[model samples]
Target: MIPFFRKIRQKLLSRNKVTRYLVYALGEILLVVIGILIALQVNNWNEGRKQEKISDQTLQSLEEEINEARSNLEKIISFNERILELSNRFLAGELTKDSLENDPTQIFYLTTYAFTTLNFAITEQELSTERTILGRQSLNAKLRISLQDYLSMGDLEELLGNFWNNEVLPYFIEKKMMVVYNRFLKQESINKEDIQQIVNEEKFVNLVATTNSMNYQFLNLLKQLDKDLEEALVLIKEEEHD
Candidate 1:
């Protein structure tokens, strides 16, 4: 193509029709400019398609992450409910202190602690990654907002971790230690009345209060997480439709 244009220019220049030659040269230059513009436009269109594909893939990944988060939240919620039920049983004297100390109920609370710890660790990493991806300013605006809200729910979950460690664990540990000490120190001839009185003391009452507060906080957090998860599912469905 370059050789063809060169030959045409040479023939035109060799002719004495300078005005016609100049007009032809201008026309050739215009054609070249138009061709370059068309090529650029095509390249831009291809790049746009690639970007959209990337955005779609990112949204899909977010959907999977949100689903995983929902599952984790549900498990946590179930665990919290069990904890509350156990607390109720203890408070109502449905399960004697001796029974609580010797039976699997104590093990249940310990297992809950372990699970909560593990879940918090794993969720923190997932939440951090979600935040990083959401922070990417190059992402689509709707996706960014949806991810931000999802991450906010994660932040709420992280807040619950503090309640677990500081408030909940201390309360359970004190109760467990009292039961263990009483059982071991006064074996066979356990003073049930005296033990109940001790557990009903003002300090113990405060500890129970703290435990209840923590449970309430956890319940509230779970509700918020459920709402966010539902919203995220809706967002994913809309994206799929789009």
Candidate 2:
């Protein structure tokens, strides 16, 4: 192609058609510029398509993550709810010592700490790194902020951990409250007398009440996180399809 164009230029120059040569040269330059522009535009289009596919994959991964988190959160919520219910019945004297002794797992339920399921570290890190791929700068920023706010509940989690370890567990051990459950675990016949004795104690009632209060607070936090995740999922889905 280059040799053909050079031949035309040489012919025009040999004929001393300087004016025509200049015109032909200018036309050739314009054509080259247009060709370069077309090539650049096609390359840009291919890159955009590749980026869009990647963005879709990222959003799909995030959606799956949110769903898993929601599932785990629901289980934790149900467990905490059961714990609260048992604690309330026990504190109100509605659950008899016989009932507790029959279901030694009731004791297990009341003492267990509430668990959290708000893990967005992977999601957050991916979003942060693929900010351009996600492309809703303001929405992405808002979701990141919301995720951080939920993660801040770690402080509450730590508080519960310290309370369980430093206060609750030690107190239960001293009172031999866990001994009944341990014996039950070994398939040993639970001493009904021990269960009755623990229930009648003021410290037993106090610890149960304290645990109930803490678990209730933790449950509320999980519920809030659930709502936020739902909202984020909605926005993300919209962005994905948009």
Candidate 3:
């Protein structure tokens, strides 16, 4: 192509058609400029396709992740409910000493019912790598808002972690409370008689109530997150059809 253009330029210049040569030169420059622009636009288009593919894969992974989180949350919710039920039963004088002794390890389990919310591991990684995720044109307003809210829950998860460590854990693992079964420390679990005696305390009954409250809050938080997860999937489907 370059050689053909040069040949035409040589012919024009040799014929002393300087005015026509100048016009030819201007046209040649325009063609070159147009070609460069076309090439650049194609490159940009390819890059955009790559990004959209990445974004789609990210969203799919996120859907799976949120679903997993919701499933886990459901299990946790059930667990918390069971804990709350048992505690309420004990408080209401429905649990006999014989019944308590029947499940002696209930003391260990109930007292140590500490839980942590699942972190958005892959979602966070994707967001960190792609700062423009929320602003992405491929992501609709609804999905973006849900994602933003869900990401912000990291702070809430962290807050819960701190609370569990500071208050909940210490409350349960008090040396006088549970001589927990520890292989590392070679500590033996308390006898059934000891567990029965421990559960007989007013503080133990009150602690059960406190745990019920904490578990309720945890369940509520999970329910809200589950809503976000469902919203996110709905938005994903909407965007796909659009």
TM-scores for all predictions: 0.63, 0.82, 0.72
Worst 10 residues of 1 by lDDT: 110-119
The local distance difference test score of each candidate is 0.58, 0.78, 0.65
Q: What ordering of candidates by TM-score runs from best to worst?
A: 2, 3, 1
- Model 3, range 1-242, lDDT digits (tens) per residue? 99999999999999999999999999999998999999999999998888777777777777788788778867876776777677667768887677865555665445344364665777667656664255554444444555665555555556556655676567556634435434213544445666555577776666666656565565566567677777767766664555
Angstrom error at residue 236, model 2: 3.7
RMSD of each: 6.6, 3.0, 4.5
TM-score of 3: 0.72
Better of 1 and 3 by TM-score: 3
RMSD of 2: 3.0
Q: What is the lDDT ranking, best to worst?
A: 2, 3, 1
